[model samples]
Target: MTIEPRQLPAAQRTLPAMLQRQAAEFGQRPLLRVAGRSWSHADAAAAAAIRAGALAQCGVTRGDRVALMSGNRIEFVEAFLGAGWLGAVAVPVNTASMGPQLEYFLANSEARLLVIEADLLQRLHTADLARTALQTIWVIGEATGSWQPPEGIRLVPWPAGAEAIAPAAVQPGDPLAILYTSGTTGPAKGVVCPHAQYFWWGVNSAEVLGVGADDVLCTTLPLFHINALNTFSQAALTGAEVVFESRFSASGFWPSMRASGATVVYLLGAMVPILLAQPEGPGEREHRVRTGLGPGVPAAAGQAFFARTGVRLLEGYGSTETNFAIATAPDSPRGGVMGWLRPGFQARVADADDAELPAGEAGELLLRADEPYAFASGYFNMPEKTVEAWRNLWFHTGDRVLREADGAFRFVDRIKDAIRRRGENISSFEVEQVLLSHPAVAACAVYPVGSELAEDEVMAALVARDGSVIEPAELMRFCESRLPYFAVPRYVDLLDDLPRTENGKVQKYKLRERGVSAATWDRGPGAPRAKG
Candidate 1:
C-alpha cells in the first residue's frame, strides 16, 4: 500500500492559521478529551478564538506576554492557542513551583496578564505584582472561595464567548512562547521559541514518526513543556486525536492508554522505571500502543521495557530550544541510542574550546538547523546569553555526548551541573541556594550521583556553621519546606570543609568521583544509616 503523508495548507503555515485550518477540516472530529467530555475541533478552535478576542479587548495586544498557570485541563489548551491567536507569547508557568520560585517566574517573564486556574489564583494574592507591571488576571474553572483578584487586576471568567478575532500577521521568526528550561543552571533560562520553529517541529516530528489520522496520541507530559507542545502537536497536523492527562500516574498509565486506544505516547526516562516497578501482569502487554518517545532509557531498561510492554521505544534527543535534533528510526542499528540527525539538522561534538571533536570522541553537543525554521530565534531579553549560546553560529546544548561511526549519538553525560532525577532537571545552583538559606548550612555543594532507579539522584555535601549542630534529617525537612520535593537532596554528607580549588570553587567532580553509597553517607550525628 502506498502511503502519502498529509500536507498542511499553505495559508496555515503559522500556529493560529494551522489551528484554524484544523478546526475547519476536522470540525466534527475529536480534538480534545478531558475529564469525561470530548470537544470537537470546531468547538475547541471557536472557544479559543473567542477567548483570544476577549483578551485583545482587555488590552492584551500583539507581542504582549501572558502567563498561563493551570493544570492539565481543557482551559490550558484554550488559553494557550487563544494567546497564540492574538500574536501574544504564552508563558506556561510550572504549577509545581511555589512561593519565591513562582513569584520570580511571573515577575521575570514580565507578563501583562495572567490566566490561572482557580486553585492557583490565591497565590497571586501573596505576590507583590505592584512592584512589577502586571495589569490583569483571569480565572479558569470556578473561583476559589478564598480567592479574590488584587487591586487593578481584572477577573475574566474562562469559556466566556466573544466575537471571533483575527490574529496579527506574524513573521515566522516572531516569538511564539517563552519556555523556562527546568532549572538546570542557576535559574531557568527562558528559551524563546518562534512560531515557525514550533510549526517546523510539528511537521518534522510528524514526518519522523509517521503519525496519521488513524493514530491516537496520549501525552502525560505537561503542556507547558516543549515535549508536548512540539511532539504532541504533530497529532493535530496529521488529523489524529490527542488524549491528554493532567498529570502522570503509573497505575493509570496502561489502563488510560488502552481506554483511549492510543497508538502513540510520549515517555520520560523516569516514567519507564516507574512503570517497570509496577506489579508484573498480563495487562502490561495488552495495549495497542505502537511507539514511545523521549530520552534517558538505559539500554538494559529500554530492552526490558519493550520486551515487557510490547511497545516500540523510540528515543530522541532535543531541548526546548531545538526540537527533535536526533531521533531513532524504527529499525536503527543501535538499540537504545538516539539515531542520526534528522533532515536539515546538523550535530557536532565539540571540546571545551568549541572546536569539533572526532566522531568517536566525547564532547559537548552543538546543533545547527540547515532550515530557517528549525532553530530558536534567541533567548528572551538576554542578548549576551543568546549570543553566547549560539557562538560560532551553532546552538550549544551544554550536554556532553559522543557521536558514533554511523552518525548516531550516544549519551555521555551533561557538562553542566544539573541533576535530572525523575525526568525533572534540578539545578544544583538552585538547590544550593535553598540549602544556604538554612542557618546551619555554612557551605554546601550540590551535584548529581548515579542511581539505580532514576536517571540521577541529588547529593549534597555541606559544612556546618562553626559550633553549630545540624542533623541530616533536620536539613532535609528544611529543604522540603522551602523547595520542591524533587530538589531536596536525597543524600547529605556533613563535612568540616568541602574539597575546593585554589580559587574557592568547590570541586564537584571529586564528589562525583567518590560517589554516594550507603556505606559513605552519614545519616546524622546519632541516627543509623539506611542501606540502599
Candidate 2:
C-alpha cells in the first residue's frame, strides 16, 4: 500500500492537524524510532497534544515563538510539534552555537521561552539573555544540576503528563518556523518557513525518493538542519518510519542502519569521503538501504559507494531559502551532474542584469516555484535585505550552476561571499567581523579554501597591528570561544597588507587564489609546514 499522505483530507488544514489525522489513519504504525524506543503515529500525536497543554500551562500563547536547542532526541520533535499544536512558531536553535552566537539567536528571535538539553545549559550564561524579551527556561534533562539561569529569567523543568488539549486551528500559510540561516552581513537572519512550504517539501521528497509505508529512513542529521526535520515530515506524509541519531559517525553508520532495519538514508557534505575511508567488512552491503539523498558527493566517490554497497546515491541541490530545485535521478545520465530541474519549478542561469544565459553557460541560478509558499517567504526582520535578494521577482540563489542541453544541471561554485563547511552555511562577513574584534587584528578578510575532505574550510588572512605579534594558536582560541567550531578558521595567514582594489575594497578573489601560500600560517591538523 502506498500510504498516500493525503489519506485524511482534513490533514490539509495544518501541521498539528495533519499529525492527528495521521494518528487516526495509521494507528500503531511506528512514526519515530530513536535508539531502543519507538513512538507510533498515535503515540506522537497524543504526546504532542499533552505537551502543548503543558506549554499552555507555562503561559504559552498562540503566535509566540519558542526557541528549541537540543540534539536529535525525540524530545526535540515533541517540543517542536507541541509548539505548533498551540499555533506558536517553533524556532530550532543550532546546538553548536557558543556564547555570543547563542546570545544573538535568543535576542534576535525574541523568543520568551527557551527549551534546551541540560548538558547544553552551561552555554546559556551572559547578560544578552537578560536584556532580551526572554523570560523562561525549560530544561529537558536532570533539573538538579549546578547550571544557573540568567537574571530575571525563571527556570523550570519540563512538566510531566499535562492533559491533551484541542489543537489550535492552523492555516497553510501560517508561519510554521523561523529557521535562522547565516546572513551575508550582520547576524544570522531568520527565514520564515510556512506550513505549506514544509508540506510540499515533504511530499515532493517522498515522490522523488519513491518512499512508501514499508520504508524506514535512518537519519543521523541534527534536528537543527532542515534536512533532519524533513525526515519526519516526509515520513508522516507517507507511512514510513525514521530512526534518529544524535549525530553521524562513519564507524557506527552501517551498524546503526543494520540494527534499525533502515531502508533509506541521507548524507551531507564530505560524508561520502569519510564513509569510504572506513575498511569494508562482512555484511556491509547486506543492509537493506536502497537509496540516499544529498549533494556534494564526488563522481569517483559516488561510483565507489555504489560499486561497494550496491545502493544508489542520488545528489540534489537546494538551500534553506529554496527547497530541492535540482536533483539527479536514481539512474542519472552522468556521474558528476545534479540532474534537471524538478517539476513545477522554473530555473534560469542569469548574468548580472538577470538576462537569461544559454545552455552550458555558467552563471547565478535563479529559481521560482510555481506554487505559493513552496519556498521561503523572506528573511525575518530584514525587509530591505529581502527586497534586495528578491529583486526582479525571483529568489537569487547565490550559487553558480550550469545547465546542459539535455537539461542536466551541474553545480559550479558559489558567487556569494559565504562559506559552507561541514554542511553548515557560514557568513564570511560575520566571521571577519569576529576576527576584526580582536584588538591585535588591525585588518582582516576571511575566505574559503577548498577542503580535500569535502566543502571549503574557513581560512583567515589578516594584517596585524604594527606592534602586535598575533599567534595563530591564540587567534584560534579567541575564535573557539566566540564562534562555532565549524566557523572557526582552520588556516591563518598573517600579512603586512592584503590585496585590495583601487576603490579600497579587499580583493578576496586574489586572496582565494593565494590560498595557503608558503608564508601562510597553516594551523590545520596534519603534517607541519614552514611559516616562511
Candidate 3:
C-alpha cells in the first residue's frame, strides 16, 4: 500500500510534533536501527522525550546551540532529536573536520555544549577553546587514560535518560539545525534549516522514492550530512524502517543490505563507480534493494550499475540551502540531466547579472520555493553572504547549467571555486589558507581537477618562499592535521610564480585549464611511494 499525501498543519511540521504523529500512526513498527540497536516508532518519540529532558537538566533552553560531532550512531540521532524537542538549534559538524574547521564551527555558532565521540577528543587539543563559547563536552565513549579536558570546560560522560519531558512548543518557522556548506571564496556558511523545511524533505523524498510502510531504508552516508539525516524523516512520515551502518564499505555494502533486508538504499555519484569497480559477484544482485537515490552518478556508470546489479539508481538535485527541488522519476524521459524541477519550487537559468537566460542557454541556476519556510531561512551569522546568495528574491545556486527545451536541467559546471570529492564539498579557500601557513610556501592557488570518477579532485599550485625549498610530500603531511583528508590536494605543482591578472588576483581558471602536468607530484592510491 502507498502512503497517502496530506498537508500537515504548521504546528505538525516541527520534529516534536512529527514524532508524536508518527508514533501514534505507526505504533510499534520499527522506525530506526543503528549498530544492532533498534527503536520502534513509539520508542523514537519516547527516546526524544527523555533525551530532551536530559538536555534541559544540563541548562539547555530554547534557542541554545548544541553542537554534535559524531558518526552514524544512535547517540547522534538522540542529540539531534533532543535539540529540536528542546527548541534548541542543532549544529551537526562533519566528522572529517579537523582542528581548524572544528574551531570555526564552534566559534561561529557560539555553541554552548558539544556532544562528540571519544576518539575525536584529541582534535580538540589543537582548537582554542578560549575563542569559543563551549562550556561543556559530553563524550559518547570512554576517553584515553591520559586525556584531559581543557581548562574552564566541563567534561562528562554520555548523558543518561532523565525524566521524560513534554515536547517544546516550537513553531514551524523555528530553526531546527544549522548545517554548514563549504564556501567557494571564503569560509563555510551555516545554512539555517527550519522545522518546516525538514518536514518537506521527508514528504518530497518519500514521494520520489515511493517509500511505503513495508519498505526498509538503509543508508551508509554519514549522519552529519543532510542526505542521511533526511532518511530518518522519510521513515517517520512514510511508516518505513531505516537502517544506518557505521560507515560505507564497498566490500561489505551488499552483505549489509542482504542482512538488513533493505528495500531502499542511498548512494552518492562517486560510490556507484567504486561499487562497480569491485570484481563482479552474485553478491551485487543478492540483495532485495530495488532502487536508490544516486544524485551524481554518471549516465554511463548508472546504466552499467543497473545492468549488473538490477538496482536502478535515480538521479536528483538538492543542496544544503534548498530542499529536494529537482528529481528524475523511474520513467524520466531522458538521462544525463539533473531532472525536472519538483513542485513547490521554481527554477531559472540566469546570466551573471541575474537576468534569465532562454531555453538551451548555459547559465547559473536560480531557485525559489513557493511553500512557506520550505527553503533555508538564511546563512547563520553571515548576513552579507545570505543577502548575496538570496538576492533578486531567488537563491543563486552558483552552479552553471543549461535548461533544455523539454524543461530538463543539464549539469554544466560550477561557477564557484569549490571541489566535491568523495561526496564532500571542499572549499579551495580553506585549503589555500592552510598552505599559506607553511613557512616554505609564499603563494598558493587551489582548484579542482577532473578525476577518473565523475567528480572533482583537489589540486594545488604553489610558489616557494625565497631561499626556502618546498617539499610536496612534506606539505601534504602538514595538511593532514590541518584539513580534512578529502580536502588535501592530491596533485601539487611547484611554480616560480602563478598566473595572475593586472590587479594581482590569481587567475585560477588559467591554472585549472593547465590541469595536471608532468611536473606535478602524484599520490597514487595505496601506493608505497609518491610519484612525480
Candidate 4:
C-alpha cells in the first residue's frame, strides 16, 4: 500500500502557539488536575506565561535550555510550558535518576537555568560541581526558606501571581524539549525533538486514537517521556480534560480511572502485567475508559485484559526519537503484532547491511515519514549519533522485527539484546515471552551474557509469581519444549524484583551491571539445576 504524508495545521507550527490556541478554545475547561486541585485552560496558560515572564526576569532567554527536576506536580507543568512560552527548551530530568546522572544531563544539555522542586534543591545544596553556567536556580514549592546557592549560582524565588506575558514567536523547527532516551544500552542521548514534530504527533495521535473534548486522559507515566507528553498534548489540542497522578499504583489504577472519569489513558508494557497481578474484582470493567494505548503488551495478556476491562488496548511501536511512528488503529487486529504503519509513515525490514528484507523475514525495522514534521530533528550535541540513526534516509530503529504480508509487524527483539552463540542467533525477547507464559513466572528480562564459548550466552532474570520458588531445571525444560535449543537460557537468576524506570521499562543496564554470576543464582525450587 502506498502511503502519503499529510501536512500539519499552521496553528501547530510552534509549541507556544498551540498552548495559546488551547487556552483560547478551552479557556474555562479544566486543563490540569493534580492532587484534587483543578487548573482551567486559562488558569494553566496564565500561570505558565507568568512563570515565563519570571524566568525572563532571571536572565533565561530564547534558545536556552532550562533543566527541570521535580516529581509529577502542577508546578512542573507550569515550568515546562513556561519554558516553551519563553522560547527555551525544557530538559525534564528524571527524579528517579541518581545525582551523578542528573549532573551529567545538566552539564550535557548546557542548561542556563535549573528550576527544581524545593526538596530536590535542598538535596543538591552540598554538591561539589561548579554551577558556573547555571545563572539561576529557582525553587518551586511552598516553604521558601533562605537556601544558599552553590558557588556562582543565583537563587531566585518562584514568583507568585505573576501576570501572563506574551509568548515569544518560534519557528516550526525550534527545539521544544530535549527528552533523553532511557539509557538501557549506554548513557542516555538527548533526543532533540522540535515543536512541529510534537504538535503533529499529538494532532495525528488524537485523530487516530479518537481523543476529544469530553475525554479525560489519565497518565501515571512520567512527563519526562514522550508517551506522557504526547498524550498530554493530544488531550490539550482536542480540548480534553487531563488528570495527573504523582505516580502509578497498580492497586489504585482501576479506582483512579473510575474516579477521574478517564476515557483514554496510556500504559507501558510492565504496567499491564502489574495491573493484571492485582486482586480481581467486578470493578475492573466498571470504568469509562474506552482505550488504553502504548507498547509492551504481551500477546498472552492482551485478549484477557480486553475481556476483563472492556477497554480496547491499542499497542504501538515507536521510540523517544520517533513519536508514534506506527500504531494499531482502534479497530485493527489485536494480539502479538504492533498493527500496521501509521498514516504518513513507511516501514520496512532491513538486514544488517541495510538491504531491504523480503516479506515475513526478520530484520531491523527502518521507518521514514514523507514529511519532516512527523519525526524528531536529531540528538542534541551529537551529530555523529544523529547521522548514525538517520542513515540511508530512513530512521533505523534498533529493534528487530518481521513484517507480515498484511503490512503488520511483529516485534522480535532489540538488535543489541540478540544473543550470538555457536553460530546461532537467539532473540532474548522471544525467549522471555515463552518463559513469561509459564504460570509460575510473574515477570522476566532476558539478555545476553558474556560466554566462554561464544560472543554471548542467553541469561534470564525472573521474578516469580507471588515470590514462589520455581526450580531452574523445570523452567529450563519448559523453555526447551517451546524454544529452539540455541535460544534456551544457559543461566537463570531469581530476583526479588526487577529494576524499572519511571515509565516501567526494565533497566537492562542495571541488570547487566549485576552480571550473570552464581551469586544471583538461587538453588531453591524454580532455580536451574547444574548442567552435566
**Candidate number of the best lDDT:** 3
Candidate 1 regions off by >4 Å? 1-11, 122-126, 145-150, 155-159, 183-185, 517-532
Runs of candidate 4 with Cα error greater than 4 angstroms are: 1-8, 122-127, 142-148, 417-532
Off by over 4 Å in 3: 1-6, 526-532
Best by TM-score: 3
TM for every model, in the order presented, reads: 0.92, 0.95, 0.98, 0.78
lDDT of predicted model 4? 0.75
Report the candidate with higher TM-score, 2 versus 3.
Answer: 3
Error of 3 at 188 (Å): 0.8
TM-score of 2: 0.95
Tell how far residue 454 is off in model 1, in angstroms: 4.1
Clashes of 4: 9
189-303, model 2: which lDDT tens digit per residue? Answer: 8988887778777877887788988999989988888898988888887878998986788999888889889899999858888888899886678799999985888888888
Rate residue 257 of model 2 by lDDT. 85
Q: What does candidate 3 score on TM?
A: 0.98
Q: For model 3, state the Cα shift of residue 109 in Å.
A: 0.5
Clashing pairs in 3: none
